[model samples]
Target chain A: DVKVTQSSRYLVKRTGEKVFLECVQDMDHENMFWYRQDPGLGLRLIYFSYDVKMKEKGDIPEGYSVSREKKERFSLILESASTNQTSMYLCASVGSTDEQYFGPGTRLTVT
Target chain B: EDKVVQSPLSLVVHEGDTVTLNCSYEVTNFRSLLWYKQEKKAPTFLFMLTSSGIEKKSGRLSSILDKKELFSILNITATQTGDSAIYLCAHCNYNQGGKLIFGQGTELSVKP
Candidate 1:
């Protein structure tokens, strides 16, 4: 089975603080994605990486950035956190079969 | 623009009742449609439908895609409380290296 693990399950940060959410997949999938899920917005893509050092902006990439220095790890960075950035962040890695495996989401609360 | 839409954003039914969730998509490079069941954490993969007319079944959950209509339906029969979760539908865009466009998701609540 494909295992996707996040660095944190829950996080709380003050306004203007820098935050980082990490995700790692054991399947060595080349495609990785970051998304923020809201009540009505569903899962809006923030950023995605197809290969190491290759990144693409999704629909809602503002106030968010991603890093893929290695194949197994993908990191989402919030330069300066704000209350509006609070949401459940999910990381996914797509396998060769076109199946996306999601990690345990990180519930971020920006106060 | 490519998008995926789900109907009946939320539903409430009894344990013994049956429910159907709808999903429609308009994607330029449609490769397949995927269904996921999310509880409180990660969304678990349920089914991936690429062919139309043919229904995919797993126990009491079944789903079928209509390529010509650009829609799909997931049906759950003999529902149990444990079957309550958010059902998500996503469109796989082959052009984007299999990037998915997800719907808002249908929240299902099965009460006893």
Candidate 2:
């Protein structure tokens, strides 16, 4: 079974504070993705990395960045947490068969 | 621009009711379509459709794709409270670098 784990299930941060969200996949998939889900907007892509030291911007990459130093781990960084950044963050890794498996998700709240 | 669109952004139904969710795409180099169910946290994979006119079924859930029409539909029968969730639709393209373009999703609420 493919297992994807997130660094935290919930996080609270003050405004202007930096936040790091980590994701680790045990399946050794090469492609990892970060997405932020809102109430009505659904899931909007934040960033994705296809390989170590390589990254691509997604639809909503503003105020967010990602790092992939290792194949199994991907990290999403929020430069400065804002109230609008309070949302559920999801990480996903693509399988060999083109199927994408997701982690449990991190709910971040910026106060 | 490649896009995936889903109808009925929100739906509320009583127990034992049947529901159908729609997804349409105008994606360039479309490879496959996928459906996922999200209750509170992560979205769980439900189905992936590649061919036209082939129906994939699992328990009370089933889905079919139509390549000719560039659309797909997921059907749920005898829905219970457990069936309530946000159903997401996404399309994968050949040149997207493994990124899946997703729709806004349909929020289904099943009342007991």
Candidate 3:
């Protein structure tokens, strides 16, 4: 089975602080994604990396950035955390298709 | 623009009952549709449908996709309390390198 693991299950940060969320996949998938899920908004993509050092902005990439220095690890960075940035963040990995394997989300609370 | 829509935002059903979840999409360079079951934390893969009229089944859950209509349906038979979860539908296109466009999801509640 494909195992996607997130660094933190829950996190709380003060406003104006910087935050990092990490994800690692054992499947060595070529594609990694970061998304924030809200009540009515569903899962909106923040950023995605297709290969090491290659990143693309998704629909809602503002206030968020991602890093893929290695094939197994992907990190999401918040330049300056704000209250509005609080949401459940999910990380996923896929090979050639959309059949992604997801990690347990990190519930971020920016106070 | 590519979009995925799911209907009946929420549903309540009793154990042993049957439920159907709907998903529709309008996307360029359509590739495949995926179904996921999310409990409180993580979303788990359920099914992946690529061809129209082909049904994918696992236990009591089954799903079928209609590419021509740009829609899909997920059916749960003999539903149990454990079956309650948020069912999510996502459409993927290679044009975006498998970036998934997701629907709002259907919140299902099964009472025992």
Winner by TM-score: 1
Query: Please, what are the lDDT tens digits per residue for candidate 2 over residues B1-112?
Result: 8888898999999999999999999988988899999988799999989899999999999999999999999999999999999999999878875689989999999999
- Which candidate leads in DockQ? 3
What range of 10 consecutive residues in model 1 chain A has the weakest lDDT sum? A92-101
On a 0 to 1 DockQ scale, where is model 3?
A: 0.84
RMSD of 1: 0.6
lDDT of 2 by residue, A14-94 (tens): 999999999999997999999999887878889999899999999999999888999999999999999999999999999
Score every model by TM-score: 0.99, 0.97, 0.98
lDDT by residue for model 1 (A1-111), tens: 899999999999999999999999999899999989999788989999999999999999999899999999999999999999999999999988777999999999999
For residues B19-112, what per-residue lDDT tens digits would candidate 3 score against the true structure?
Answer: 9999999999988899999999889999999899989999999999998888999999999999999999999986887799999999999999
Task: Please list all clashing residue pairs in model 3, or write none if there are none.
Answer: none
Candidate 3, TM-score of its B chain: 0.98
Q: How would you order the candidates by DockQ, starting with the best?
A: 3, 1, 2
Best by lDDT: 1
Pairs of residues clashing in candidate 2? none
Residue-by-residue lDDT tens digits, candidate 1, B8-78: 99999999999999999998988999999999998999999999999999999999999999999999999
- Output the worst ten-in-a-row residue range by lDDT, candidate 2 chain B: B92-101
